[model samples]
Target chain A: MSIYIDPAVASSLRGFEMPEKLGFGKVMAPVMFRAVCQDGCWSRGELLPYAPLALDPAAKVLHYAQSCFEGMKAYRVQGGGVGLFRPERNAARMVHSAERLCMPPVPESLFMDGVRTVSAYCANLVPANSGESLYLRPFLMGTQPDLSVSTSSTCEFYVIASPSEAYHPGNMRLWVERENARAALGGTGDSKVGGNYAASLLSVARLKERGYDQSLWLNPGNRRTVDELSGMNFFAVLDGELHTPALNGSILEGVTRDSLIELARDLGYRVREREIDIDELLGQVESGRCEEAFACGTAAIISPISVFGDGEREYRPAKAPGPVAERLRAALLDIQEGRAEDRFGWMQAVEAVGE
Target chain B: MSIYIDPAVASSLRGFEMPEKLGFGKVMAPVMFRAVCQDGCWSRGELLPYAPLALDPAAKVLHYAQSCFEGMKAYRVQGGGVGLFRPERNAARMVHSAERLCMPPVPESLFMDGVRTVSAYCANLVPANSGESLYLRPFLMGTQPDLSVSTSSTCEFYVIASPSEAYHPGNMRLWVERENARAALGGTGDSKVGGNYAASLLSVARLKERGYDQSLWLNPGNRRTVDELSGMNFFAVLDGELHTPALNGSILEGVTRDSLIELARDLGYRVREREIDIDELLGQVESGRCEEAFACGTAAIISPISVFGDGEREYRPAKAPGPVAERLRAALLDIQEGRAEDRFGWMQAVEAVGE
Candidate 1:
């Protein structure tokens, strides 16, 4: 893909020093991938030095939240090379998100070119330690300078990488968010858009104040069924079987969630994808029927839920990290880190650009 | 307020030319007002030449839509000077919007300073026509360059002005949106956040394709009561009495909507703020009991609704611009443009900056 390599990229990369502390999404790489779309035409991708973006004050994204993004990781595999776990799914979901916001979709080829270019060049920055890797964020935004609440004619797509550790390190306490919803049914919930994330911050903040790590949001339509956490999918182990909320219209189709389902089924664990009522799940947790509960996403791979704070009441599962959750997380990581064979063929190896 | 007025502002204003065509929010003024907040402390406000904002790529606003805005106007009063109609109300509403998105609220005094400073400097650009004014858009966004799903520590606030004609110049045909929702039940619908506007765009685009001007959204909580149009509040003249949807948690309390309610009462018209079911309203429109319906906002003061396009049927009000809507529009405009006495003391006049 004839991507443009900015002249200063080499210097920026060479001059960059990896920090001693690599927190999640904190230490950004020195270079980034960018492409622009104007009037339905997509420009060739370019790798340029990372810098502030000069945006018009009246850009649609600043006023209307016409933006979408994906979180992914480029892992430094078992032996040598780097691999992207199901990058194609992220591209497809991003297309759906762009269409939902009426922004021009970045074609799969262009999306791949941007992701691969950034991953190949920044391969050295990928963390080698277990539970750490180079996190890639591909974001698209409406850049047209207008105050009208309409679709933007111009768009900018960017892919920025950050070498960081895993997001959540310990068991999490979740507050049952009955008052606020992350997204509405028949809304942008299924899409990885900025509005859904924007709507979730208040709930997370409130939960944090109440001594919880995250919010366990219920479905907006029914207001009783499980939806997801702020940035992850919800899962529980009941009666020695894995249960997760089905892909409702208001639930984001998480790539890690999908991978886990496949990997779990392959590992001989019975997985059920159906509507799981919140009250019923909480009851199971209290009755000791639910062995463990967890949340999964690209950032936090698998964070076990230790306590469910529902208003004044708190419920805990039999185990914080049950045997099933531990097994599934290990199996998934082995495939992701190339310690085991990529039986599912989910990893896309990216060739590194030699120094 | 001691605002920092940049030296380059004079040159920008002096060299600016007004475009012949003044579409709504199209012709931007040459200068803007800006202020920054870092770690809970706000910087002094500044008035400088309007220029592109250099934001970090990882700024929370771009990736998570942590932004809110208010639309207001500085009118060219009947005699000579410019006046802002209930500018304090806008400031108060913006505070609520910012708080909902977990951003630091722009202090009321600072908000007034930004709006007044921009309006005074751009006084010459306020259009003189009845429905035209200097449309001022005051926006606040989280500017911290972090990828974590948390509230931003840094924020930027700005007020930009556009001299333009009224939005929605003619009668509007609205499509009854039954599928997609603009906001959730306990979402950012009541606040003037970017996410609510972003979520409404898809429904608007779909309706525009079906020959409708806007989407007549339903209350997300019940999905039956009339909530609003995309960016405006809904009102109807039923049985010669004005009725509007109450300020449900999912409805934005518009400034125009509130002003009209007060003005209508002064004009000896009964105004009701309660739930108006969509099906019942459609039936009333079909039966000629609903004389006219309209949408109101800062840009579009009062736009009469001609038809409501349900799935396979179209319901029309007896008159597109019935006497009630007509009289209310004229009354509101009269006070706004200074043709009538500011009986409610809503107009806040600003002294122009000498050239």
Candidate 2:
């Protein structure tokens, strides 16, 4: 569904100026797209200047945490055109996330409209360089101000863009987080809901104290199998093959992780999706059977992990950025940066709307 | 801190009238309280008329779920007075919940002032029934309008109230929630936060479809131990003594649970706080060792559990509102209703500011 843009949007986009230092997601674009859903019927979305929201203090999203969001990027594909990578995946995952929280699912068509509209209008704000792009955050929240725990009957969906530089996930050491599970069994771990992230902050805080950059969360069902990181998916090189956790109920289906799996297969690498038992994996890392491990997400693409620590014991690899991680990162960046073929049909080229 | 009464508050409260039917937390009170915090320092709270909150579209609370809240009541005690039962506990729990999300804590004094001021001004709205009261909801949110996941530097706190009737918790048949966890292990289960409630909504919805009232969550760490109900603490009268899951990291420290333990001990009943394994609990029920069980919180003073359904198996207790639950519910209600003495100093009497 095409959106009817307001006349003021052009002026807002034109008058907007980008900050010199574009942090990860701190700097937002000038224009946004918004839609409302009341009693299961959705209204037509409108593109307007970015503005603060008006909500009752007792809104279910504020008090009950009935909110979910999607993270995707508008890339400056080759030939100076803008496009989005795996936009449909974010839309589908967002639907699942909303269902997990008992909120009405923002339709995939509406989700795409919001993302594509903002991305096309703010194409000038899409950053250059390898990792930098205009990060699009599409979020839906329950707006009915009430004190009950039932499903919210009213909802609002908005797409806000942040002009971001390549998120440089610095040298990372991971802590084998055993005590805290990010999502519980049959919980919203597989869905991208706000509650899952809120539940993870405590573990991330503790891992930061232990001098680790991220916590390698274990599966909540068994507390023995490997789950994804707080915001990314994990990949380890074992026995000359690439291995990642299967899509369990508690692991988010990351877009970046999925792209890498397909790319790895195309590049003639054997990939496996199975449970990585924490104890067994740690032992393999200690014994040199597991050579290198890394994490992948849309924000940073791929970040290599150098060390894995569990309590006092530590496991370090001979190389921080191993050959496999480096090769995969460069391959993915090549496609994203327009330096390679568009054969995989991964990127959807968006027409640039004049500022 | 002394607060200046806003002129608009008087008009809003005067114009507001109780609705014909007051469901739980549905009809909101007209007035509210607000305070701002920056860099660990808090501003004096002001009681103003309740209105829609103005928030940035990219606020961290909406996106990252950096928000926490408390549930409590302000009872219109017998003899023409109003009082709050152990509200300080909620204030402290809100602080802990905020800390878990890395957000600034609402100052204890500021929190107290907000609740008391709202309750004092809206004392007339409190229902005069045995189990009914002015349900007070105190929530703290990260209001900084940025989307990145690090805790917000600026925050806002608000206390809103809802006029309601007695929460008649019928004899509930709980579904043994072996698959879904309300909160994660090492997660925010123990904290009074929005995320935990949102995560539990799915489980509640699924169990309702299966003809169950609420979910009996298991300890996420082991998945075999009994934690508590979604928002209440669990207690069972086994072998003529009160038994509850000990204050494990996963179980919230319910104020009513604490008060009941104290009141029960003083009334010559032995109480034990230990790990209540689910298997052992079911066995005890079958063998006639456990006679009755109940769940307690501010909303429902004491809700008796009638049956436990674990997937294919169903265990019906010999008694629903057994002698223990009946006695405890009456004992607690007497103090709340001002019929009995507040011997433990649990009630804080609030003098109504009548014109």
Candidate 3:
């Protein structure tokens, strides 16, 4: 798919000012990539000036929540280069989410085209800090203006970038949410859709009030096993082995979670994916058998899970951001930032734009 | 609160025509009611022309699925007057949906005023047909233009009306949806939000090809008891008694469902609200103990359920509009259409508009 570059894109990017302080997903890039789909056929992509989109009140995305998005980052590698860490995984996962909503799957090639084009154009905006990078938000929405309870015939896909710091909610404390189940069994739990995130805000808000930074959502199907965090996947080091919840249909198959598993294995750590029952996990954490735990995602690369509070019982891991998390984080970051060799071929380099 | 009357509303209402066919929610009313909210404070309501609403692409509702809605109706009661059928129930339910999405509840008085005021002003437009009325849609959406995944501080609430005939998908053959679920356990299932409806569309579309009118969604928590249809509640007549699923937290508390139960009980029919197991109901239907079944909503009111098509087994009800359903529907319609006494204190009479 050929990209139609608007002549104004360069001026927009050039005139943009980098904010004095960069926070996660707060400061947006100057330009964006947009594409439209009509009757299942997609149009050529465009690199245009960033602007607000016009939507109708009855648009399906506004009402029915027919929206999905992908989060990834373009980083300035240590030795003066730019790279994306497994962007194709995000692209593939977005397709899965779209299909779940009966929306046209954004083709893998188009998905790559959008991300790579945006990353290349916004390369200057890529933060040079070790944890900071240009965060790319690739989103698809159903924009049909109607009140019907059916799939929309028109859709728009856009890739917007936010240049900022790493999403490290340091030494996170979590609340074990029991009253609400995030995604139901046979529901859109595993998909990276806006609805999933929307459904999670209430719980997050409730937990935040109770001095918690996140919620350890249990599997909706059984309400027993540990599914994941709202936007991240969970992992615990039990008896010197890395254990994470298996993909149980309702947990988002996170890109970072997957990379961590492969990297951990290569780093000579035994990683096992299985159903971690909530009760058993709490027990293990309380008994100090589970050394440390953390959550992983594209935006927040790796956040140390400090403690889990379920009702009156509080289970604290032996360490937060312990030796294992620190090591695994370094191993993954090394490949992503080019500090170490791209041994696993996980990093995909993009051509940097001349400022 | 004072209403801002847009002059365009008068013109739009004057131009509206009664279409030859009113298929459910397809036809739109000429006028709509609207109100805005900012940081938990609400603006005065407005009655305006029904037209396209221009919304920002980055609006919270589109990006984060921050929206909720209510479905109710203004009926041509049997006494030749317009009256709303238990609108407060819809108001309470909308509040629940709003809270789920971290939206402030539209005040109960505001909710009642919006529906009643719109209905009274448009009373002349209420269809005079036997099964036709003005279907009202009250929805709230996050209107802030931002890409962040948090509750929008600014929101807009609207009540739009559409006069329509009965939603009679005659002799509905329902597909037992075992794989895909409409809402997650801790998800938005209990709330009448857009995401819940959008999630169920794929299943309905798939089943439509299989000659089914709707998909009978099971409870997402325990894939056991019946949850509901996309926008309606389910009912079954077993061994000459009225039965419906109890208000498990996951199922929406439907106004029509509540009304029907009361009507059935008042008419001296044995009404039971409890779990209706899918397999057991199928077995009962097959063995002829379950005489009939139907679905109910504000638009459809009461639609006969004919066949329950599970993948391997199909249970066809002996009677579609069974005796119990017919009796209950007639009694409710009589009260709604002015053909009987308003004995149960259900109807709220709206001011009649001069032709």
Query: What digit string (tens of lDDT, one per residue) describes model 3 on residues A86-162?
Result: 88898999999899888999999999999999999999999998889988888898988666688989999999888
Q: If ranked by lDDT, best first, what sequence of candidates would result?
A: 1, 2, 3
List the candidate numbers ranked by DockQ, top first: 1, 2, 3
Restricting to chain A, the TM-score for each candidate equals 0.99, 0.98, 0.98
- Between candidates 1 and 2, the one scoring higher on lDDT is 1
Which residue segments of model 3 deviate by more than 4 Å?
Answer: A7-11, A79-81, A352-355, B14-21, B77-81, B120-125, B145-148, B352-355
Each candidate: chain B TM-score: 0.99, 0.98, 0.96
Lowest-sum lDDT 10-residue window in model 1 chain A: A161-170
lDDT of 2 at B94: 90
Model 1 Cα displacement at A92 (Å)? Answer: 0.4
Clashes of 2: 0
- For every candidate in turn, the CA RMSD to the true structure comes to 0.8, 2.0, 2.4
For model 1, the superposed segments whose C-alpha errors exceed 4 Å read none
For model 3, the chain A TM-score is 0.98
Tell me how each candidate scores on DockQ against the true complex.
0.89, 0.76, 0.58
For model 2, the stretches where C-alpha displacement exceeds 4 angstroms are: A283-289, B286-289
* lDDT: worst 10-residue window of model 1 chain B: B164-173
